[model samples]
Target: MSESKSYTGGCACGAVTYRIDGDPMAVRQCWCRHCQKLSTGGPTHNAFFMADAIAVDGTLASNAHAADSGNELSWYFCASCGTQLFGASSARPQMRAVRLGSLDQAHELQPTAAIWVQEAPGWVRIDPAMEQHPAQPPAPPPQNQS
Candidate 1:
């Protein structure tokens, strides 16, 4: 069998770092207003993985708020440089969304879906090949537990 792939990355200032074993369960671009605000008017690209797959080091700061779906969402960042790191939702505590920009540059992952398209700005042009969702789509199937 092939060896499981591992990905590594850290915050802009290198104060926080993380490693993820295996591949991501899903990659998506979110255009929700909250995401836009976080991304400075652009979509937030994320790679969702089984929460257990991620191992982080160093202190992290976080902010939690209720989402439109009623799920409590929390964003984690490097306390020093303020670089966003990961996001988690109460609706799927077993999953964690790693900000794409936080992943190592060598990683090849890319968003396969665009969600909350209804909230995308008129000037934004989503890739025609990507699966589009006017709003939140169904959660990704559960990852292997073993």
Candidate 2:
């Protein structure tokens, strides 16, 4: 087990901000087409954490879409910078996905898995050491306070 200190972050324009505590349950590099659309044709490096562990501030613009799993997913972004910051999904109400790029400490968080490998473009190279999955990886354990 490992422990990470609380961290604060925001969008590039500082219009939307967040303070999150506790280590993330998982960090992933997702190559789904939707992810590629979000990241300009690259994987989106994201971290999943319990919703209770985070506090967000400032106004945001949001959009809803269906994920590859056919679940409703809503993303919140900074209206000023058009930077996507966080995501909430109907399939995983207890968890929220934070875009790693928005985190001030993103450099320290590494993707432990690469998902949607089958959808990745041939030119993209994923780390050989990372766990790869054709689709979504197995669900992570629920957050535990004790």
User: When superposed on Cα atoms, how far off is each prediction in RMSD?
Assistant: 1.4, 1.9
TM-score of 2: 0.91
Please write out the lDDT profile of model 2 over residues 50-113, one tens digit for every residue: 8899998988899999876888988889988889898888988889889998997645788989
Which window of ten consecutive residues has the lowest lDDT sum in model 1? 1-10
Clashing pairs in 2: none
Predictions in order: lDDT: 0.92, 0.87
- Which pairs clash inside model 1? none
Q: Across residues 31-138, which tens digit of lDDT does each residue of candidate 1 receive? A: 999999888899999999988999999999999999878999999999999888899999999999999999876878999999999999999999999999999999
Candidate 1 TM-score, C-alpha based? 0.95
TM-score of each: 0.95, 0.91
Instruction: Tally clashing residue pairs in candidate 1.
Output: 0
